[model samples]
Target: MVTTPLAGPTDRPAPGRRRPVPRRRPSARARRRSAPLTLLTGLVLVYTLLPLVWLVINATKTQDGLFRSRGLGLDRDFALFDNIARTFTYSDGAYTRWLLNTLLYVVVGAGGATLLAALAGYGLAKFDFPGRRAVFAVVLGAVAVPGTALAVPTFLMFSRLGLTNTPWAIIVPSLVSPFGLYLMWTFARDAVPAEMLESARVDGAGELRTFFSVALPLLAPGTVTVLLFNVVATWNNYFLPLIMLKDPDWYPLTLGLDAWNKQAATAGGEAVFNLVITGSLLTIIPLIAVFLLLQRYWQSGLAAGSVKE
Candidate 1:
C-alpha cells in the first residue's frame, strides 16, 4: 500500500506529451502506387463493357436505324419490341427452335457434365483406386489442350460413329469438363472432412448413400459453380456445333445467330440484320440472369474453399 502511494505523476504520460497523430491518411507513396491500379481497373471496366453497350444500343434500333444511326448510341426511332418480334417470327420461328435446342443442350449436356464432374471429383478426392493418378494426369493434360485443338479429332471420331449432326454430338463433347473436374476435386478435398466420411462409414452408410446424402449437401456451392460454367459453355458453343451440325434444324442459338449474321451480310438480306442484333441481345439475357441469380452460391463456394482447417 505504501509503495502504491509512492507512485508519482511521472508514471503517467507527461502532460505536454503529444498524443499519437491519427494515422496520416495513407502515405503519398501508397496513394501514388494505387493511382495506376485505379486507372487500370477503369480501363478494364470500359474494355469489358464497351461491347455490351454497343450491343444494347444497336438492339434498340430499326434495321435502317442500325446502319444509319451512330454506332454507339440510340437512334431517333426505337424498335426494340419490333426487332424482338421479327427475331422470334423470322424463318418460320427458327429462333424458337434454336432457343429450345440450346435449352436442351444446357439442361442435358451441362447438367450431366456437372453431375459427372461432382461424382468423379468427390471420388478422386475421397477414394483410392488403381490408375487414379493416371486418370488425374490425363484430366490435367486435357485441361491444357484447348477445345479448339480437339474439335477436329472429336469431329472425326463422331463422324465415324455416325453421332455427328445429332444432339448427342454436342452433349457427348460437353459431358466431360476437365476444368470442372479439377475445380470440384479441389473443392471436395477441402469441403468434405475425412472424419465425416469415416463417421458415415462407421454408421453403416453405403458410399453412394453417404455421398448423395451427406457430401452432396456440402458440395452445393461447388456443384453450382460447375453447373453454371458448363451451362454457359454449352449454351454459347459455336465452333463445335458449327462443324458437327449440317442441318439448320439442329443448330443451337450460337450457330443460328451466326447463320443470321451471315445472311445479313449478303445482298437483299439487310432486313435480317436487326433480327440478328436483337437475337444476340436475347441470347445473353439468360446468361446474365443466371449469373445474377446464382452469384451468391458462386461467391460462397469460392469463399468457403479459400481456407483450410
Candidate 2:
C-alpha cells in the first residue's frame, strides 16, 4: 500500500544532525565590566598616536605659521608642498646628501648585518661544533650590553685606525648585531628541520646549495624580522654617528637634522626650524613604508615537515 507519511514538527532538526547552537548575548554586567577596558584601550591608542599627529600637523606649517598658527589646527596658508620643496633645496641640497648617506648606511650596513646574522644563526642552530655554548653565552652577553656603552670605545678604536669621519664608522659597527643573531638562532631552531638537511645531503647537494635551496626559504620570516630590527637600529643610530663623524657631508639624517635643529641656538645661526620639522617627517617615511611592505611576512607560516597522522 502506497501510504503517505504524516509531517513531523517543522521546527525539529533531522535525526543524526544537531540544531545550530544559538549565540548568547553578553550580560549587562559583562558589558559594564568591558566598558573600562574599552575606554582604556581607546586612551592608549590616542596617547601613542598623539606625537605622530603633532609631527604631521607641524610639518605642514611654514616657519611663520609654525610659530603663529594654532598647534592642533591648520594654518590659513597651505605651504606643505612649498616646505617640501624647500626642504630638498635648502643649504645647497644638504638634505639630499644626508638622505643618500642614510640609504648607503642602511643598505650596506643593515643589510650586511642581517645577512651575517642569518648565516651565523643558522649555523649555530644546525651545526655541531666545539665552543658553541660559549658562543651562545657570548652572544647573550653582547645582547645585554647597551650600544651606547660601546660608542666611546668604538670611537676610540676607529679614531686610532683613522676610520672616523667615514662611512665605515657607521657600517662596521652596524655589522655586528648580537640581538639579531640571537633572534635568528632562536627562530631557526624551530623553523628549520634537521631531517630536511639530511635528505638534501643524501641527494648529493652541497652545504651551500642545501642552505640556499632548502633552509634559506624556511628562514625568510626570521630573516625579515632581523632585517627590520637592524634597519631601524642603524637608521636611527645617533650616538655612534655623532661620535664618529665630524663632516656634514658624512652625516646621517639623525645628525644632519640635529644640526638643523641647533641653528636657532647657535650664535650666528638662522632659525630653520621649519626645514627641520619637514625633514624629520621625510626621514620616517621610508621606515613606515618598509614596515608596511614587510608586515605580511609576520603572518605567514613557519617551516613544517611531512604530515603525520
Candidate 3:
C-alpha cells in the first residue's frame, strides 16, 4: 500500500537499458598540441596579408608620399582617385589597352583550357580508350615539370612557328593545363555514376548528349575551379608575356605594370610611381570579384563531387 508508483516511461531507462554516456572533453595534451599550430597559422596569415595591406596604403598616397611616408602607413594626401585616373590616362590610355589585352587572354586562354580539361577529364574517367593510362602518365609527368622551366622552350617553339609577338603566343601556351585535366579526371570518376550514363544511353542519348545534359551539371564545381585557376594564371602571367610580346599595345597588365615600375625607377620618371601602385590595385580587384562571384558554384561542385551514388 505504501509502495511508490511505477516509474514513468520518460523518467528512467527500461529494464536492461543503459543510459547514454556523455562525450569526454579533449585532454590538456590535445589543447597544448593545437596551440603551436594556431600560432603558426596566425603568423602565415600576417605574412601573406602584409604586402597587400602595404599596397592598399601606398595606393592612397601621392608619388612623393610613397617615399616620404612609411611603406605600410597612410600619408596626409589621399590621392587614390587621382592615381587611378592618371593610371588609366597615362601614355594615351595604354593601361586600358593592357587591361583589355589581359581580359582577352584570360577569356580565350583560360576558357579554352577549362573546356578542354573538362572534356578530356570526362573522357578519361568514363571511356576505355587506347593509351588512356599512358596519357594519364604523361599528364602526371607534365605536372611535375614547372611552367617556368618550359617557358623558354615554349617561346622557341612558338617563335619557330612565327606565332611570337602575338596574342596566340600567350593564349596557345595557356590552353594546356595538366593540373586542371587531372582534377577533372578525379572529380569525374567519383561524381558521375555508371548507372546514370547507362540510363541516358538506354534513352537513346548520344555520348555527347549524355555528357552535356547529364554529366555537365554534376561537373559544375570542378569546371569552375579549373576556370578560376587558369584565369588567374593567365591574368597574372609575367615572364612569358615579357618574352613573347614586344609591342606595348599587346602587353598584358602584368607587363604593363612592370613597364610603369621601370619608368618610375628611371631618372625623369619618378611621377609614374603612384600610377603603378594604383594600377596594381586595379588589376587585383577583378580577380577578387571573380572569386566572390563564382565561390558558390565552386563550393557546391566540391561538395557534390565528394559524395558518391
Candidate 4:
C-alpha cells in the first residue's frame, strides 16, 4: 500500500487566520457617564409627581380623615363618591356649572386660537411680503412680555369698552397667543415643503385651496400641538378669569375650587373640604383623557418638528 505523505508545516494554514475578536463590553466609565442624567431625571419626576400622589391619597379620604389621618395612609372610609356627589349637588350644583363653563371656554377659545395661530404661522412661514421680519420680531417681543404685565392694561381697556365681566374678556385675549404663533411658525417651516406649494399652484389651485387640500394634512402635527397647548392654558387659566369674572355663576373650575377651599376654612364649611378635594381630582380626569387620546398626534407633531433644514 502506497501511503501519501501528509502536508508539511509549510503548507499548514497561517497562524494569523484566527477569528476576529469580539468588541469589549462597556467599561465602568460609560455607566458612570450616564448616572448623573438618570439621577437628575428621577429627581425631576419625583418633584413633579409628589403633589399628584398626595392629591390621589387625600381625595379618597373623608373630611374627618383629611385632618385626622396621616397624609400617605388610606382612610377608614373611601368617601370619594360621596364627596363627588356633594360637590356636584352643592349650592344647586354650582360646581357642575363651573365645569361646563370651563369646557365651553376651552373649546371655543382654544379651538379658535389654534385655527388662527395656524393660519398666521403658515402665512408667516410660507409666504413673503413687506415688513415680515419686523412683524415676526414684534411677535417675539410680545411673547417676552409676561401675561401678568398685560393683565391690568387689558382689564382697563375692557372696562372702558364695557366688555369686562363677560366671556369675551377671557376668550378674546386667549385667542392671540404669540407663543403659539412662534411654535406653529417653527413647525410649519420644517414640516411643509415649498415644492409642494409650488406644485399645487402649478396645477392651477388657488392659495386657499392649496392650503386646505395639500397643506392642512401635512400640518396635522403642528395643529394638534398648538391645540393641546392652547386647551391646557385656557383650561387652567386662573388669573385672567379672576380679573375678568366677579360673579360666581361664571366662575371656572380653578376659581371655583379656590373659593371652596377658602370656604372650607370656616366653621360650618368644613364639610366642603372633601368636596374640594374630590372636585380637584375629578377635574384632572378630562386632562388625562385628552392627553391619552391625542398623544399619538402629539408624538407625530414632535417628530415633524425635529426635522431640520
Report lDDT per candidate. Answer: 0.90, 0.92, 0.91, 0.88
lDDT of 3 by residue, 1-309 (tens): 698888787988878989899999999998899999999999999999998898899999998898899898879999999888888898999999999999999999999999999999999999998999999999999989999999999999999999999999999999999999999999999788878899889999999999998888889989999999998999999999999999999999999999988985678875578888889999999999999999988645333443355
- The alpha-carbon lDDT assigned to residue 308 of candidate 1 equals 51
Worst 10 residues of 1 by lDDT: 299-308
lDDT against true structure, model 4: 0.88
Please provide, for model 1 over 16-97, each residue's C-alpha lDDT reduced to its tens digit, 9 standing for 90 to 100: 8975787768878988998889999999999999999999999999888987989997799989998998899999999999
| Candidate 2 segments exceeding 4 Å error | 1-26, 305-309
The TM-score that candidate 2 achieves is: 0.91
Q: How many residue pairs clash per model?
A: 0, 0, 0, 0
Better of 1 and 3 by lDDT: 3
lDDT of 2 at 22: 100
Candidate 1 accuracy as TM-score? 0.87
Pairwise lDDT winner, candidates 1 and 2:
2
Query: Which regions of candidate 4 deviate over 4 angstroms?
Result: 1-24, 265-271, 299-309
lDDT of 2 at 91: 92
